[model samples]
Target: MTYIGRFAPSPSGPLHFGSLIAAFGSYFQAKSQQGQWLVRIEDLDPPREMPGASSLILNTLESYGLHWDGSVIYQSQRHQRYQEQIDSWLASGLAYYCQCTRKQIKQGGGFYLGTCRHKSQLTPEGCSVRLHVKQAIEQFTDQKHGVITIPHQLAQEDFIIKRRDGLFAYNLAVVLDDIDQGVTEVVRGADLIEPTGRQINLYRYLNQPEVSYIHLPLALDEHGNKLSKQNHAPAVDTHCAKETLIKVMLFLGFTLPDDFQSASIEQMIEWGCQHWSLQQLPNSLASSTL
Candidate 1:
């Protein structure tokens, strides 16, 4: 089977150093194996999305020599596809309409206890759709981290596939998109590891082939918090793309040649593909200062 990987980013803000780490890690992991690396713009949430952030992200990737294999996919354009899957699940009795509020779930111990699983007749206007979750997957092996076990309550809970506001949930959309794209592997940040079992369960529900996973270590700020756009982590400097690329390489635990400082961006990337190794990556959170 052809090894296919992807770099998916939400268009909520500019790509930061943390974002670059995920992009490059996925890009080189695919390139190293002569696999196809695809880019997907996860523009699912309209309220949280920033104007023109998708274009800026694509431009930044291009500037850093991280060109992808095909035309970028936008989740906003795939609403029909997402809805179709939800409809199929609803029809098959695999899912149902839920009227449970966030406060209600939190008050009920933070795990949804299938309050609305029997309420399929609930009006869709004020309801979100949730999977029945008969097969709760509690464990999966990560390519980098190995043998991860999810909390039983989280794994067993009936999770929402669509929001009360009529938006597709990330877990539902991401799994369907990966299946549609024929992705063989998912290389992303470790921060997403908690959801792997949930995504895997979705794959099982759809009877689709499961993809392999490699979650790279998250980049953390000086305060030990994950570097994210919400935390005001600065966008990567495109003006110094080469330097930033070098820093990313070092963070991934690659040892460059003494003369690599003078190498062009393309050359550095070429070298990276030729030398990429999963074993070289650091398992702990990487400091953003690097």
Candidate 2:
């Protein structure tokens, strides 16, 4: 089978160290296997998206000599596609409208409690779509985290597929994107491990072929907060592009050569892709160095 991987990043901020590590790791992994690497803009979270951040991310990747196989797929432009999928799920009774609000759910221990599971009528407003979740799946090995399972309550809770405001949820977007892109391997930040089982359930429900998932240790701040836009992680310095690339390569488990330490961005990418190794990556978080 032809291997395919992706580096789907939410454009809430410029590509920071953490973001760079994910991009470089996935890009090189695909190249090492002589597979295709694609980029996708996970812009489903409208409120948090930063203006111009997506364009800047693409430009930054190019500066570091990490180009994708085809056109970058943006989620914003694919609303109609997501709606069609949701309608299909609804028609098959695989999903239903959820009317629970924040206040009610908090009292219900974070589980949806199936409050609206039997709502006879679908309201035009004040409802979210939820995938009827199932029982705990048996142990499945994460390429890095060893055997894994979603916490029982989380795994069994009927999770949201569309928010109350009618926007398509991340869970729906990710699974559909992978299926549409023919991505066989999903290499991404480990912070998303909790959601893997949920997405797996989505795939099974949709009758889509399962994809291999490898969650890399996240790059965290000293306080151990995952480096992200919400945490105020600084934007990457495109001026320090070459040096930044070296740090990310090292973080992804590549040893830099002393002679080529002063090499240009293209040379570093050439070397990085030639030496991608999944074994060198740690199962825990990689803290960012300033």
User: How do all models score by TM-score?
Assistant: 0.97, 0.94
Clashing pairs in 2: none
Model 1 residue runs over 4 Å out of place are 284-289
Summarize candidate 2's per-residue lDDT along 1-290 as a digit string, tens digits.
99999999998889888888788888888888899999999999878888999999999888888889989999999999999988888887878988888889998786767788878597648889888776544455776667876677777788889999878999899999999999998988777777888888878887888888777767878887888878998888888887787778777777778876778888888887787788888755444443
Give lDDT for model 1: 0.91
Best by lDDT: 1
Residue 238 in model 2: shift from native, Å?
1.0
Q: Quote the lDDT for 102 in model 1.
A: 94
Q: Which candidate should be chosen as best, given TM-score against the real structure?
A: 1
What lDDT would each prediction earn against the true structure? 0.91, 0.83
Residue-level error in angstroms, candidate 2, position 257:
1.9
